[model samples]
Target: MSGTGTATGTPTGNESNLESAMQLMIQTFHKYSGNEGDKYTLSRGELKEMLTQELGNYLGNPQDKDAVDKVMGDLDANNDGEVDFTEFIILVGALTVACNDFFQEYHNDDKNDKKGK
Candidate 1:
């Protein structure tokens, strides 16, 4: 990468960049999932399954049973056992931040490696 804030040779705040990247991911998920209807939603099981399958190594098996249960408990709003758009957005926002932090660490490690070389 060129740099953190100016990676593309343009100034951008970390939060703004993060939001933009997340919006793209959200739009892509909506399109790929065919969530065209206003009432479209995903149940806890479906959400966890999708996260595990799509996110793969990022999610890392949910740590344990309690972790999985806690996540479902938090995201399943309305007591309907499903996550709506709002819940989905919140869930994805947290996940995106986690993924971004991982990438930042990897980038820093790579930079250190280059310097060592």
Candidate 2:
């Protein structure tokens, strides 16, 4: 998919991987934000649904109300009881960082194994 338009103009598909990722993040946020309440924010139910449908593999047991509540408490930065795009992005950014760390560690382990063999 192509990058999204900035203050300048529509971005072409030839944009960098980071640009495409930014567009995808925007798209994903919108995909789940506007269901029950504010069009730009996610209500608790909407957040739960998004978590279960989009990040089930990573988040696990999204059906667990306690887990969902904990996430909601943590992500509601402004204490508004809802998750805005900025808050949602924080969650995504954190997960991406975690995944990167895991991959780096796994790669290092593989390299060490190869060296030992």
Best by lDDT: 2
Clashes of each: 0, 0
Candidate 1 clashing pairs, residues 3+ apart or interchain: none
Model 2 clash pairs? none
* Candidate 2, 1-117: lDDT as tens digits: 334456432467677878767777777788888688898999999999999999999898999999999999999999999999999999998989999999999999999999999
Which lDDT value does model 1 have at 3? 26
> Residue-wise lDDT of candidate 1 within 42-110, one digit each (tens)?
654556555665665776786466666777788877777666767777877798898899899999999
Q: Estimate the TM-score of every prediction.
A: 0.55, 0.86
Candidate 2 regions off by >4 Å?
1-12
The TM-score obtained by model 1 is 0.55
lDDT: worst 10-residue window of model 1: 1-10
